[model samples]
Target: MRMHTRIVPLAMTTALLAGGTAAMATGAAGAAEPKGDVTAQSCYGSARNYTGTPGGPGRNAHWPATGTYAYATRNCTDINLKVNYTRDVRVCFKNTGQCNGWKKAKKGVWKVAASNVRDGAGFYIQFKGANRSTGKIAY
Candidate 1:
């Protein structure tokens, strides 16, 4: 399978690498809404939301509904993941086993700026504890 990659801005990259929550502040304003096949896991109060184009199957209970989660303008650029939960949630940017770039969100809506997200690589969000959601960019 062919992988797609992109380039992002410097400021965004710097902020993400610094482990800052600046990306999260952006929220969903002017951001593209998630669209496509959305599958919800039966946990943490099952919910409904939009799904993007690139991702895996939608049955993994440990992960969020798998599908195209977000879109970016360029390589290493920024993709936003909007989290709407009622409590603090942990979001892992890439499924790298470890939540290395994971960010925490309080009760409310949050737009997580996933900076430096490369192509061939997708985005995944684990809400609550076991509800892991997945998405990717295929174009």
Candidate 2:
């Protein structure tokens, strides 16, 4: 009888943990869709912005510059995984001619995608941009 009491609670706890894991998995699986294409937002307010003037290829005082910024589109549409952007930003830039083929033509500009997770609502990313000739993310 004593064994039965111990087993009952153990079984219950195991069941709960299992259920929680399943719930999380379900959430992650839900966001596995193609997600179409990831996009980067133009420079704007905040220190990350670099659309004002042009800077040479070498690093600058600004944190994130504009140019051929490359990053993977990351979406945390799942319930289990928390957005791990604190370390490194991961995302595929939603390429647009608006930046004028900084990616397709390989203008030589390099940009890193911010790990900012999208709420699956109105999410936008910001990457590097260049003057097309210099291949630097000065703007």
Candidate 3:
């Protein structure tokens, strides 16, 4: 009957569409890696957040200047920082057990721990030495 004929074409079309959609999703999952600046904001939003530059040759983590709390202008070239507090935060890195207070820090890459920042305080890279606070960043 006419109804049966129409049903077959509709069913075939639906099946084909579904198959194509599934294939496309699978392909997307295996696409190229992500690029650009990486950022992590607080649950309450930008009030407390951090951003880092893309990894490359001799490139270290850098923070923005102003807008938010805290500041630092240092490129962490060969070190990683795990910050558990903000504004005089305690830092721990490779080869160093207890780094000096934020004020007397050095220029290098830091991987700030979001959950570690205390009491809703914002994260900021601390640039040490003479030219302190080249910049700061907020997520």
Candidate 4:
């Protein structure tokens, strides 16, 4: 009876230790992975009213008022946009004159504006129609 009690406790302790070690290993592995898959390096642009008119000839069709540039904090492959209201918006690379097609983004939803964007690239929000806009940019 004494031997049986001692063996049972020893086995339980070993099993508990092994389970804990496995859990720790899993946590470590997860920590090493990329934090965000779609928006790895996200930068937020505060919500603000965009008071601008539609673009005309000689001016970009999607212009007038633009949001601040959200620069990539880490290397990323795509440029994403999100807004608080359903509006027509596009992402333009700073100083590159490269812009993506205007996409109608739903409120609080993420929309991919451009892909193959390099790290540290700066991008800003352009509106096709004027309205209050707010959201984030990530790659």
Best of the candidates, TM-score: 4
- Sorted by TM-score (best first), the order is 4, 1, 3, 2
Model 1 segments beyond 4 Å from truth?
1-48, 51-63, 66-76, 90-96, 130-139
Model 2 lDDT per residue over 44-103, tens place: 111122232233575221122444442322322211111112211123333443311212
Task: Supply the TM-score for candidate 3.
Answer: 0.32
CA-RMSD of model 2? 15.0
Model 3 Cα lDDT, one tens digit per residue, 1-139: 9999999999999999999999988888757433433233222123333443322344323343433344222222122342323223323322323343543233342444232333333343433222223223332
User: If scored against the real structure, what TM-score would every candidate get?
Assistant: 0.33, 0.26, 0.32, 0.53
> Which of 1 and 2 is the better model by lDDT?
1
Which residue pairs show collisions in model 4?
none
Scanning candidate 1 in windows of ten residues, the lowest lDDT window is 37-46
Model 2 lDDT-worst window of ten: 78-87
Each prediction's number of clashing residue pairs = 21, 20, 7, 0
| lDDT (Cα atoms) of all candidates against the true structure | 0.39, 0.33, 0.39, 0.62
Candidate 3: list runs displaced more than 4 Å.
Answer: 1-7, 20-115, 121-126
Task: Supply candidate 1's per-residue lDDT for 17.
Answer: 64
* Of candidates 3 and 2, the better by TM-score: 3
